[model samples]
Target: MMDGASQFATTMLLRPWWLLALLALALLSYLALRRVRGLGAWEQAFDPALLAAMERFGHVVPGAARRIFWPVAVAAIAILALSGPARRIADPDTFRNLDGIVLAIDLSRSIAEGGSLDDAQAAAQMILQLSAGRPVAMIVYAGEAYVASAFTLDALALSPVLAVLDGEIVPNAGSRSDRALDLAATLFSEAGILSGDVVLVTDGDHLTPQAFDAAAQLAAANIRVNGFLVEPTARHGDMPAPDRDGLERLTRLGDGSLGNAADPAPLADTIGKRAASALAKGETAALFFRDYGRYLLVLALFPALALFRRAT
Candidate 1:
């Protein structure tokens, strides 16, 4: 019960200035009602008994006085509607573009020295291009993770950064995609994005149990982690083969798909479709209060119809 009261107390008026009109309305209603009840200037000029007699004899219609109440009631309802009372509500449609894309590029030795760095960069760039107009973030990780670029709508701003990314840029020396996944989740939280996609571009050479755990956590948080496998060139035979099985399993746990680096169209399409699906299901962060004044205005129709009927 206390919680309910606390929630109700949070309701606010959007147009509080409209409330000042209520004082004027109250005064006018008082005067109008007094006049209807035969308590106006006429009451001062004539005896109370005389007015009572006039009302009794039908010289003054008591029913007409009662009719004034309807209009006053209508005006009060209209004034309240104009005040714009509202409270915060979980309205996913309130932020249609809250669904975003986070590109987590693996900058480990396997990707940088395995002859697949170009493929990783290309895959990142392709996803960014296809995800135009959407809020996109970038995470570059090897032994650790770093947000190369925060959420932004301009793909061009991130394209150049992706072009220059390599395993050497990150001082870390191991592969930890798990850290990347965790960092992506943090990014979404900081940006107030409730649901989004995480595109992991990697050679898939370092898959760990921790990575799978991170993917499951992301899925729980409504963030899908898709895989972009960057196959190494045939000449680089010493590099470990891409961990296709592990990548596929990670994607499955994250409720996402695994795509080949050679063609990013399907991966981009999947991201787009999933984001749209989340939005269609009203899965988004609530960023603002939903105004309920318009709904209150609907109640005014009752008194309005009464006034209309009386006038006719």
Candidate 2:
């Protein structure tokens, strides 16, 4: 508890000079000892704890908790002191093309096919490379949209999530294009948000008018909804499919004749291409926002911090 007070004091001062608390306390101890020697009558008046406590007062009162408060005051202040945010030093240079992005992938039945999954994964890889390790959010859409992952730059962690894209995960007995499109908008307005592009991955077959309307809504919110169609091909009997028709042309739909992912190589190549193009854009990336609670991290520690607290 007293450690917290010391930390708070340091934070309030925000000055390195306050670190001399120990030296100042030592000098005070010398002066006090001199007085004690002068009054040689009452030698037993000072106990060890009392003397030590007095010394601590000299240091802790002014230095230990000069400005800090709150239970996590030490942790919070340390975080602020060590690597201060956006601090401009003498020769400051910032990296180029850094931004947040959200990748809204279609997990409809059509993506279960060979080519669809490949294109989607490739797109993610390319985006990761372009973002220079910026946080990316992941959303999977089918008859509905589910957030598979949250915003992060951990590329390796995202690989397994990208691997599990099938009709099995989301039972798309009938494609709900409207629902999927709405998910796009909902995804953007979520936690750990950053300004970036939104990449929609799906076969052109699912393209419906309603989904286009939803995309337009997202675009209006500075979230660019770019379409990536996994076109149907006759290779190994794989066909092309896209979620929505044109944003304007609802009734008149065009044939989505694209690549055939007979083998995994072609599928991988396609996904890579789309992802590369989208990710290369400096302000574009993949955002994977998740709904994980703080308990997960706290549980790793003595989560009892929340379970029990001071009566006051």
TM-score top scorer: 1
Q: Which digits, one per residue and each the tens of the lDDT, describe model 2 over residues 1-312?
A: 997775444332223353455455456555655654443433357665775576677632222221222323333334333321221111101221234456666665556654457766676555555544445677776776777776676645777787766668776454555565566456556642433455555555556667666656655554555545554332344444343444223212211112322232442343333322233233331121111223233433443343355543
Sliding window of 10 residues with minimal summed lDDT for model 1: 277-286
RMSD of each: 12.7, 17.9
Q: What count of clashes does model 1 give?
A: 0
Where model 2 places Cα greater than 4 Å from the true spot, the runs are 1-98, 192-194, 234-312
Error of 2 at 3 (Å): 41
Question: Which candidate achieves the best lDDT against the true structure?
Answer: 1
The lDDT of each candidate is 0.80, 0.48
Encode model 1's per-residue lDDT on 1-312: one tens digit a residue.
999998797677767899899899889987787767655566679788998899799786543576777777778778888887777664433353577899999888777887778878878887887774578999999999999989987866898898788768889888888889989999999998867899999877678888899999999988888999988775365567888888999999999999988777788776755543345334221235556777877887887777667453
Model 1, residue 269: C-alpha shift (Å)? 2.3
Q: TM-score per candidate, in order?
A: 0.61, 0.44
The local distance difference test score of model 2 is: 0.48
